[model samples]
Target chain A: MTYVVALDVGGTSMKGGLVTRTGEVTVLAGRPTGRENGPEAVVEAVRAYVGEIAGLGRSRYAGPPAGVGLAVPGIVTSATAVYSANIGWRDVPAEAFVPSGVPVRLGHDVRTGGLAESVFGAGRGVADFLFLPIGTGIAGAVVLRGEPYGGARGWGGEIGHAPVWPAGEKCACGQIGCLETYASASALARRFTARSGRTATAKEVVELAVAGDAAAAGVFGEAIEALAIALASYVLLLDPALIVLGGGLSEAGAALLDPLRERLAGRLTFQEPPPLRPAALGTRAGMLGAALLGWQAAGEHDVGADWPIDVLRGGSVS
Target chain B: MTYVVALDVGGTSMKGGLVTRTGEVTVLAGRPTGRENGPEAVVEAVRAYVGEIAGLGRSRYAGPPAGVGLAVPGIVTSATAVYSANIGWRDVPAEAFVPSGVPVRLGHDVRTGGLAESVFGAGRGVADFLFLPIGTGIAGAVVLRGEPYGGARGWGGEIGHAPVWPAGEKCACGQIGCLETYASASALARRFTARSGRTATAKEVVELAVAGDAAAAGVFGEAIEALAIALASYVLLLDPALIVLGGGLSEAGAALLDPLRERLAGRLTFQEPPPLRPAALGTRAGMLGAALLGWQAAGEHDVGADWPIDVLRGGSVS
Candidate 1:
């Protein structure tokens, strides 16, 4: 059976895998990106990771791998990695990183993860929805008619930069009161540190909030309020059936979801509030989505197909 | 040549017209809606206007009228006028008002007007754009890939309800600090009257601002600021190629466009500010858009076609 190489390239690490046509994934070794070295090193690391995954597929599968797919953060178009703040790359000819003669597909990491969720995770079978991953930074994927919506300039899902409070804090993006300034994981940690002079992860902040710390509660409350305002605007504009929250903060689970749902519902008067659910696939979604993209690029499988049938059959993948 | 009857139903009056296959439109007699007489009178007024326009088309055109199209306010879906605060309509079977033999099309006035602008006005040939008609209320139409984007629930462009000031005034929608409370034409007039204890139209408020009345300037300035905040969010999300402002306030022309452009540009940090243009088709856009829909329902014209080719030729349409 044919297999495909897939990679989810992040600033620090590259997650690689060899996925069979049947959606069975053989976990391949990861590599430190060494992006701190430079942008070229990052590209080289991605290429090397792809090579390792291909080797694993060739050793285990009946035939050579069909293609490769890469999911990267940034302003990605279909053919190019336009710009990525995380990777420190601009206009990178990312497809060239794949080995010669192998078809390659490139997509934004958030959108690719969204596609994975729409197929196999929380958003499964939902035609119109939003996938928001609030990690170090916030970004979103707008899934419409079961496909990611890339607006006119391929900037359809930059929901994090939306102004939630016009008079609020300044963002690194040079905007004031952006949703990212308050709701993103990095923002939560930074705000907590500034107020309490204690360096804590967003997870720790949530814990402190639950443990009855007033300062932590204040920071968390502000983040939730900003998220609710931004989401209210999205609900008015898109009216999606559901919103799936992923990324690091989402692991807080009900601590994050309950308040967000209540605040968002309160903000909406005539509009129906969309159901909010946590992403089920965790960090593996980007890799799975890359595998799906690889299958599509290889022309061996339809991306439109309800994929990972094994997962749908109530089976787990290890 | 076959013709279509189109009516733009407003709270106070109905603007009717007969449009030929060649895009030439003959203005038909208007009718008072007398909405104060109640919902039945509103529905009857719409039906009578449609019949009058159909009769006009039959007498003036070479063939009998082909179809009818009605543009109304409120939460309109593909088939039903789900709700209309302006006309006090709910789940109205709007298509039934047209004569049985004629095909009929129903659409929201804002979306229809936006379609008309996309085909023949300021947004002509622009694939992704926004049309905001800030009349009594401040709803918008998001035109993506040259068609109106009706979100999953057909509530795609309700920009007015977006919260601009979380601690600000209450809105009829039950949301506080909504953009409509400050920026809409009626809002400007109402705020001015409530403050100065004198009644004035939105147009008169603009005149006062231009004449250096500080209180009027304050109200208009607040409206401009609120509009800028909401538009910044839209730009961050959709990145439309252009933004077209229509309706009563747009008649203020440079007065509305100049400061709004400056404020919007100032608010955008990384994203390019879309060019803000006044709607060129004016009040007649709704009627023209209705005609296009009528032609489509009649199966005589492709709504997707670059229609009203004459308008593109720089010829006048009155």
Candidate 2:
């Protein structure tokens, strides 16, 4: 069976996978992006990881992989990694990340994750929705008409930076009242510590809030309110069919969904709120989406649509 | 030259025109919608107006009009008027508004104006932008990839009702701090009268503000700030290449555009603010867009691209 090498490159680490045409997956141990060593080193590390993954695929499937796909941070097109402030890269071609003679494709990291959700996870069968992953930093994949739309210049879906209070706290992005300032996973932890002078992870904070800790509850409450306001704006502006929540914070599950649903409904007077669902693919979304891009690079544009979700979720790991 | 019957249906008035395939236009005097008479009468009024314009087209060209296109208020599809709270209509088929056997098309009023801007006015050649008309109320036409988007259920582009201040003023829509509560033309007039204890039109309030009246300046300043906040949220979420401002308040010209540009820039910390320009079509955008839709119904989907801007602006009126 022919397979492809897929990589999801993040600010700190890279997850690699090998997938066959029918959705069988073998996930490899992740590697550090080594961005601290400089952009060129990071690029070299990616190439090396891809080469190693391809080597494994060749031994198992008895041939070179069909194609390669990498989901990279920052402004990306299918042909190039335009820019990534975190990775300190500029205009890196997709070819540089794969072996010579192999067709390769690239996608924006968050949008690729969103694409996975759209094709095989929570957003499956839904045409228009927002794929929002509330991680350390918040961004969204505006999936419209069955594809992620990155507006005029590929800087679209910066929903976290959109103001919630308009005149409230200053964000690290220098914008005032940005939703990320109160609602992102990093913000949850930071604000919780700032309020009570006790440090805790975002997950811990959520648990504390659920257990009725007043400081955690206050911080968590603000996050939910800020999220409600931002989501209300999103619903009014885009009127999506669904909102799929992902990333580290969504692990709070019903704790996040139940309150956010009620608050969002309260904010919107005239329209019904779209149902919110948790992301199904978890951290593997970017890598699986990369596999789809890999198949696209291999001229198999329709490959991922029929991939069984059970096989994708039940895949073996090494 | 063959022509089409085009009508723009508003709450209180209907504007009709006969537009030739080669872009020649004859605009007729508008008639009151007379909604006080009820919904059936409104539909009858529209059909009679369409018959009148088709008669004008036949007399002018010695043949039946090619098609009829109407831009109506509320939820609309190309083939049906789904619902209009203002017009109090439900599921009115396109054929009911025009002569039988003459192909007909319908469009949402604000989005139709945006289509005109996209095809022949300010948004010409721009692939993505927001066409916002701040008239009696505020709504937006989200023009993306050269077409207007109505989101999942044709309830999109309600930017006016998107909250600008989460805890601020109570809006008539039962939402808190909607953009319309502070920035709509009606809001300006009402807020000015409320603050100064003197009734004045929105235009007079603008003039007074420009001429150094403290109450007028305060009211206008708040409107601009509210607009800036709403627009900043739009920019962050959509990242459009440009923003086209239309409707009654936009007539303030530099008085509105200049301060708004400055404030919008200030709100954005990273991305460059898109250039804000006035809508080129003014009050006639809806009627002109209906002309394009009329052409589309005639299966001439590409007729508007070559229409001269000067000719559209200088169309004869009776």
Candidate 3:
């Protein structure tokens, strides 16, 4: 069937699988990223992980995949320049991480996840959507016409650093009042700890909020309000058909969605806010998006011609 | 010698010119928009402007030129539904303003201006640049690879409405602390008047600041500081190669760019500070942009197929 391999390279872990054309992923594997040693070590680790995935694919499918796609965190200049704060790698050329002529495609991890959800998962058929993953930090990927929007120099869907609480908290990025400080899982945990004078993980706070604990409820409600503010601005600017929520906090489900929907409804009047929905594939989305990029890499010289609009629409511009 | 009629619609007036492929404008004239009477009046004004331009072109050019390119202020949804607060327009089908069978290309005014600048003006040869017109309200146009980034819904450059002050004065758009309320020329006048207890136009304020008037300098400094904050966020997000200041505020020349550059330098690192330059053309940018669009409307059918990359690089996804 000539399947492809997809990988998500994170600061602490690498997760990926062999994906078929139908969006099915097999040969799943997880391993430590060991990125603290810097760019060279990170490159070697990614090569080794991709090799292991290739081995699994050959052993199980009895055929080598057409190509490989890899997703990574932080600012991605192109397949040529990968600078990541999470992984501590600066300007690592993407083609250097893979074996020669294996046909590797590189993309921003969140954007790739957004592509996966927009194409094969929850955001299917929606023309515009914001994929916001509220985890240890909050970052977003914007999808338009089923393709992720990478702005000038590939920095469009950067909603996390979009400045949430201008006077609220100081971020490690040296900015004041970033959204991640309020809406991320870490934000939830911090708010709970600040209010209750007791340390608790985000998961614990979620449980307490569900159980109707006043302090936890207050913190959770505050977090939802912050999310609403950020998403409301996004709505006015992008006017997406829907918004997909992902990451660790999204697992709380309706507890997050209902309040968010209410807050968004209160603020908007003229804009057709995208319907709210859950991300379909979970953490595996990055891998799937990378796989899609792989498919593109293998088919780059085909009918599409790698034209920008074709790259954006997978067909033509509207 | 083929030419097309171009109509540049603004909140208060409609300007028209016969534009050639070589970027020449002839027989320019303008009439009051009188849009308060609603869509019908606006359409009539537009029709009259187009008629004059068409007459001028027919009398001068030999071949049957293409259709018209009309630029208007508002959130344009396709060739229909133009939403403008000043003009009091909503869901007004733009094609209704044109003669039947005339290929009319409708575009947001700022985006159209951006197109002109990118192709024929100061931004020429720059792969990426952002155009911020500091008029009564501030808005931006993202130009990449010789085109404007018109988001999925044609609203990519809404930098004015992007939040700058967390607890700032309420905006008519129902948002608080938008960049428009601080950095625009109108904002400078308002802030200076309130601060100095003496009413002054934005230009006068700049003059006073240059003359070392403390009160004027303080208020002008505030406006520059606000621009710095907004541009910092912009640089982090889009990372355009250059930023061109346009419109009335930009007319102040070094008065606007010099301080804003210093403030921005103080804020960002790791990202190269793009050289800030003044927009070469004056208010004529809109008219020139409209003409450019008309010239392209003559050839857009061929270009549409390849427009997405330019769009994405321009902000196709928002």
Among the numbered candidates, top TM-score falls to: 2
Off by over 4 Å in 3: A88-95, A210-214, A265-270, A300-318, B62-65, B81-85, B88-95, B99-101, B144-146, B300-318
Q: In terms of TM-score, how similar is model 3 to the real structure? A: 0.87
Q: What DockQ does predicted model 2 obtain?
A: 0.86
DockQ (model 1, Cα): 0.75
Residue range B1-318, candidate 3, lDDT tens digits: 777777778888877766555444563647789877886787777877676667656776864458788888878843764688778778777578776667677778887777666765668778678888888888788775556766666656777776667567776678677777777888888988888899899899999999998988998887887788777766755567889889898988988888898887765644656889887666767776766666566775322222221221111100
Per-residue lDDT of model 2, residues B139-161, tens digit only: 99999888999999999999999
Task: Please compute the TM-score of chain B alone for each predicted structure, in the order given.
Answer: 0.91, 0.98, 0.89
The DockQ-based CAPRI class assigned to model 2 is high
lDDT tens digits by residue: candidate 1, A192-226: 99999999999999999989998899999999999
Tell me the docking grade of candidate 3. Answer: acceptable
Q: Flag clash pairs in model 1.
A: none
> What C-alpha lDDT values do all the predictions have?
0.83, 0.93, 0.73
- Worst window of 10 by summed lDDT in candidate 3 chain A: A309-318
RMSD of 3: 6.8
**Candidate 3: lDDT of A61?**
73
**Residue B216: error of model 3 in Å?**
2.8
Q: Count the backbone clashes (under 3 Å) in each candidate.
A: 0, 0, 7
